[model samples]
Target chain A: MSIFEIIGAVFLLIGSIFLFLGGLGIFRMPDVYNRLQAGTKATTLGGMSLILGVGFLMVETNWAWMVKAIIIVIFIAFSNPISSHALARAMYKRKRYPIITSKDENMDAYREVNENEKKEEDA
Target chain B: MRKFLVILILAVLGFYLFEAFSGLGLGFPRFEHGVKDYYLDKTVSELHVANTVTSIVVSFRGFDTLGEVTVLFLAVSALGSVLYKRRHDVGSRSILFASSGIVRSGSKLLFPAIILLGVYIFIHGHLTPGGGFQGGAIIATGFLLMLLAYENFRVSHHVLSYVESLAGIIFVVIGLLGFIDGGTFLQNFLPSGILNELFSGGVIGIIYVMVGFKVAAELTGLIYSVLHEKD
Candidate 1:
């Protein structure tokens, strides 16, 4: 209806697109860790955008609602990364190895470094 | 044969549920005058509260709420008893997993903020959508975060029980005081102050505050007992 409304709608559209892509990534990603990475990044940005758009829409009408929206956005930003990290750490502790392809030489190098660290600890 | 019977029963149940749900109207009836009108019309003038839901929960249906709180208290006590361990064993129990320094520090920072938000929600229950139950749950969640991040985090059982008992006693005493003024149980005996003000709504706000404290302490204690159970 208005310029602010139009901007808010655009943000909502972008956020929905990111959320859709994040869902797609979850289904397409090779393993738990990769999926977690894709899912968390896209969803966090998507959710923040959506909340920000809501704040924009309410900016003129209600300052309190806008402030509440910003608080929610801040909470999501702080909690999302911590939760993702916890999930990844739990998976690692469980020894759930990611699917590795022969082309990924980096995995081998990472394993070698881990082994070296274990040996140092043992000695 | 067993599989076939199970499927048959589920199919019948699903069909019955679908039929029952479809028979119900989706919108409010145009020609019905019911208790809804009474509550909507009288809640503001009678209770001097802006929120009809609070008036209903704390004043009109106070007895039901008391029963519900009692049920919750019983359930939590049962859970605690089931999860109980020998007193000496609790001190020696080791945490199964330890979170990283980042998580621990972040949770420590966020914990107080979360509790403050929860308190705000409960305190503003009459003015807003949130109430004692929601706020108490949020407070419990803050405690849960502490439990998960810090192995040494502990809540004293004595403190929790005292808070829970005191809140419950205060709530009942307030209800009893209503009788002194020839009012029904939990009746608004005190002057319902001007609407929408923090001190308005008289007994409603006080009861909700008591409920908030009771629920927060109960849930936190329940969580603590469950978490401390011997593996």
Candidate 2:
């Protein structure tokens, strides 16, 4: 095969690997937020690489078709993360999952603020 | 426990009964003799749209495009109504604009480029895989970038609504005109010029332009709603 074909093949392989990792992350992740980040980010990158590979593999006559395919890839790459972020934030607000751990120093301060607000409201 | 079991049984039975009674034929799309072949052959060349699917959607199925735009409009409205924040509420965290150099400069560079690209796609939609929907979404992204990179940015609601409504009304009027002049609702009433050139298709480019505007407006409205939810 030609060098172009080899390069395309490499991209396709790498994309598939990332896609597999995304699925693994989805299945193994403990919580909704982490799963979403893992799944969306990996799949978006995987999808782009796969499409780019396919575009590269096309011949001259099909160049326009390949370009069109790449445009779609670009569209998905931009939109997916934003949508996922929105959904995750909504879930977090709804308290859909347990917080596994907290290493931050401001946790107690946040709690104190909430307590003060409650006390003031009761007064 | 017994009541729960009975409810589950009834639900399962109801689903089964509905599926069995449903009259939908389990089959793929059927073609009438050479009709599909003829249209497929003529579409790309005649419409100057590289993607036959896009041509079919925006031109032949123009009414569907109208419905899609309306759906998006309704979605924006619904999101707005649901997510509207009370004046007293402290709202979502205010986005700080004093980020590092990379985000500030990167957005400044990327925003204009994205807008130009959106316009380019919309204008050349007839000759490309990109169409009204893609271009509209791209335009929305440009607006979104501005909103993110600059906290003070606010889209002009009056101007956006005026443009959006005008485009939608024009689309409907064109469709109505098609029915008045011809048999089909969105029939190509205008002249169909020679293939593979700008301004060649009859009513196709007009429809695409309308769709592009409508989609851009509605999506931008949706993004605005999302951002201003905590306002």
Predictions in order: lDDT: 0.85, 0.76
TM-score of 2: 0.61
lDDT measured at residue B201 in model 1 versus the true structure, 0 to 100: 89
* Clash-forming residue pairs, model 1: none
Residue pairs with clashing backbones, model 2? none
Residues B44-146, candidate 1: write the lDDT tens digits. 8877788888878888888988887888789889997777676665665665577877888888778998999999988988888888888988999999999
TM-score of chain B of 1: 0.93
Q: For each candidate, give its TM-score against the true structure.
A: 0.91, 0.61
Task: Highest TM-score: give the candidate number.
Answer: 1
DockQ of each: 0.56, 0.12
Task: Tell me model 1's lDDT, rounded to 2 decimals.
Answer: 0.85
Q: Give lDDT: candidate 1, residue B67.
A: 85
Which regions of candidate 2 fall more than 4 Å away from where they truly are? Answer: A18-52, A59-123, B1-61, B67-101, B124-130, B173-189
lDDT of 1 by residue, A1-102 (tens): 778788888889889999999999999998998999889999999999898888778777887877888898988988889889888876765678677767
